[model samples]
Target: MKIDGSALIAARQKLRANFPGRGEIGSPSIGTQEWLAEQAHVSIRALQYLERGEGSLSNLKKVCTALGISQWQQLIINYGEDYVSCIANRFVDFRPSIYPPENPETFANSSLLMTLDPLTLLVAKGKFETILLQEVNATLTGLAEPITYTWLAEVSLTPNGQGWLGWVKEVEPMNLLANDVPMNVPIMFKQLCVPQVSWGAFVDAVENLTTSQLNIEVCLIFQNFTKKFKVYVSVDLLKILFNEGRNKYLSPLPYRAQLKAIV
Candidate 1:
């Protein structure tokens, strides 16, 4: 898939939103483009090239890494034939506000329909805060019946300490995303207590787990990355990930992140 200019601009703005300052959003402690170039181990113009979506894949990855973009896919526009061309009706909503709203829904994921799929969310909020993300396995809760999901991994990040959380279960796998690559990645992050597992575990774990419902909150960011997005996962939809065998699932998205805030 090719990185579009709009993705580049979106990534830049997302990165900027991660920096801290005073009042309003926060202060920008990351400093100038020169500093960003230094951080990403690229030249000034190379950083510029990337910000303009005109850089090598290596440069883009480097910039993405330095900026703490967990969902680097958000920086690129297309993923072959799987891109969602038309927005589906906004079918899902998170109650109790999983996170504070920011940026006035400028990006595609902001659209309720766009976010409904289990795609990577590049969540950043405060400067020197934490970046938390999740491959949201979204399902409309009230579509038919009430489904209880077994929650997995809930840990604290901030001192005040809200935790990022998810639920796991076994069922006939379904595609949360139409795109193959993002769908079947063995999506997991390193944590102290919980063992990492692939998304494909559903092929086994669905049978492995006797029931569907366990809940835990976990830290989503380590240092400064991004804020958080409020979301709710439904247990009624037991979906498997995309491209489990095609890609190692480690190359693109991040492995290390901690919770900045969550509820």
Candidate 2:
């Protein structure tokens, strides 16, 4: 499998520029190759090979992790869309369902209740559905702890012409589905609020992009993470959720072209 060394180098350089000081995990300054190699646990030689487009995919992934590049697929510039599709189909999975969990009381104490009405309206009107990424791991670049982030990605289309809207809210496994959720699940206990701007742009892209694009930019929202980074999601996965959601829910009103948020 061929790699795009230029793309890899660009991403690495961008990370170095964005984070210029010493990194966590006892690593050296982020600007140096040796520091990156240490963070990725790859030999400096292997890193060099990768920058030249000659390393294995395993090494590429490690480099991606160290560079804060959540999805290695973003670095594969020469690999055509088909390659991305193949990878997306094989690895990405979407678990879609209705929002406002069956147990509403569990979230009664949550401070986000006020912002949920728009979501509730969509669900009640059969216009909203959520996709859960299950367990996603993310670490703040300067922080020591690597948190397992779990999100319930809320999605809804805006009338037909207005495009789509979305919000990714943090969920606590215990309060989320305490009764049926297993203890071994990777859902986080801490709730970090997602910024409106971040998730808004994500769904907006989804609405405008073609399936060939395959990947969508997703934000990793952490309370203390100063820098905002992205996680690439397979567009196909979201399509799966949309298809399933549309078929699962039936609206009673005559199909209207216009939909409005309950503000």
Candidate 3:
């Protein structure tokens, strides 16, 4: 994953110039190059190379931390625009609108897609995974019959050091209410090891959950890691169930995130 060098340099200069110094913070701030080098604990040459977008990922990470940049995604989100060619499509593939027109005659409305915040799973270092299970509880009151529904999550995992990788075991569609059955379909289950790149799996369990169809719980379990972590995204489909598909057009996209460990 690459970042815009010019953006990095601009951010660094702006921050360094505005940093508290002398009477402002009761201590004098050092020169830009020297201060950044000391804070990041790296050579001045290394910082210069990174400012030009010609440094290693390790050095970039260090400098970014020194600049109060908590996550790499921050750089991409703040500076990813106008430098799309330098970054991967999977890392920054986001749009404000993906809704179809009103007339169903032109659009089949077979599928809807969404992108969430980048996910990082910290399996080592004792960092716990952030679990978010959102249940779409809506009724299909006004729509055509035989409404078969399906879902899928496309994810990408990049490990940091020698961390062992883990994958999505299975997706269970449960009845959030009483003992009501969500849909006519059976249980949805699948298992596969996720590679470094993107991998997508569809939940072929329920066609239609009627009114009680809700709750899709997915658990990502990480075993162990020394200095490894994982980062990825969750791409979900938007199949609005109530109010004549008005909910899908309400928001840009639903957001969900996963975290990684740093042990």
Candidate 4:
């Protein structure tokens, strides 16, 4: 994705917002560009470029790490009002709010749940397959479902002769559960099933899960029928789930072992 220049500028403003004396150029504690350059192991020229929001991702990550911050989001929030306002305005335009009065008709359906199919789920799982799994697991538990699933396709396995089609029955949700929860409690299950098991049926089933918030327990199954099916998920959903303590289940043991073996 192309970097947002305005956001980058605002992020810089946010980073320097609280410097002593409103970011006086000579404040010793604030650290000079030269000092930051040396600390980050980057050239002075590179540091200058980064300050101007023209640096590469590697340089940006290094500088951000040295400065003890997360991503550029923090920078935008910490900067002055201008930075915050710019981001707010940009986001509003990007994803405008639908307040009741302004969007009464929309509000009528606000509580409606949207169901997603396998392809939709895959798309939503994109960079956050882990988050997607956690959400799926949480949904299952909350609804008292009896099965859970981990897509073998994600691990690059083909469907044939008990290869990717084999389901890891009674796969433990122990790892997926919140640590605060008592381990002895009978964990709920969501019947784990894969689309390829009944490709047409799987698509419809996923759609149902996505649309409704009903409590129902069902067996989960997995099967691989196709050799070339791919899905993508949204980054925002992943971030939301990650923030809401649903980051577990993104990768299960079998997948991890497969990754390790490949490496």
Off by over 4 Å in 2: 18-27, 77-80, 83-263
Rank all candidate structures by their lDDT, best first, as comma-separated numbers.
Answer: 2, 1, 3, 4
Residue-level lDDT tens digits of model 2 in 30-85: 65677878878899899888888778888999888877766465355333222111
- TM-score of every candidate: 0.28, 0.28, 0.26, 0.25
What ranking of all candidate models by TM-score puts the best one first?
2, 1, 3, 4
Residues 185-250 of candidate 4 have per-residue lDDT tens digits of 112122243321222222223334443322222222111011122122333332333333213433
Name the candidate that leads on TM-score.
Answer: 2
1 or 2, which is superior by lDDT? 2
lDDT of 3 by residue, 92-156 (tens): 22111112343333222223222222322211111122211222111111223222222233222
Better of 2 and 3 by lDDT: 2
Residue 126 error, candidate 1, Å: 32
How do the residues 44-161 of candidate 1 rate in per-residue lDDT, one tens digit apiece? 7887766665667788788778767655654453322222222212222121112212321221122111112222322222221222232222222222222222212222222443
Q: In model 4, what is the error at residue 173, expressed in angstroms? A: 32
* Candidate 3 overall lDDT versus native: 0.34
For model 1, the run of ten residues with the poorest summed lDDT:
254-263
Query: What lDDT score goes with residue 25 in model 1?
Result: 31
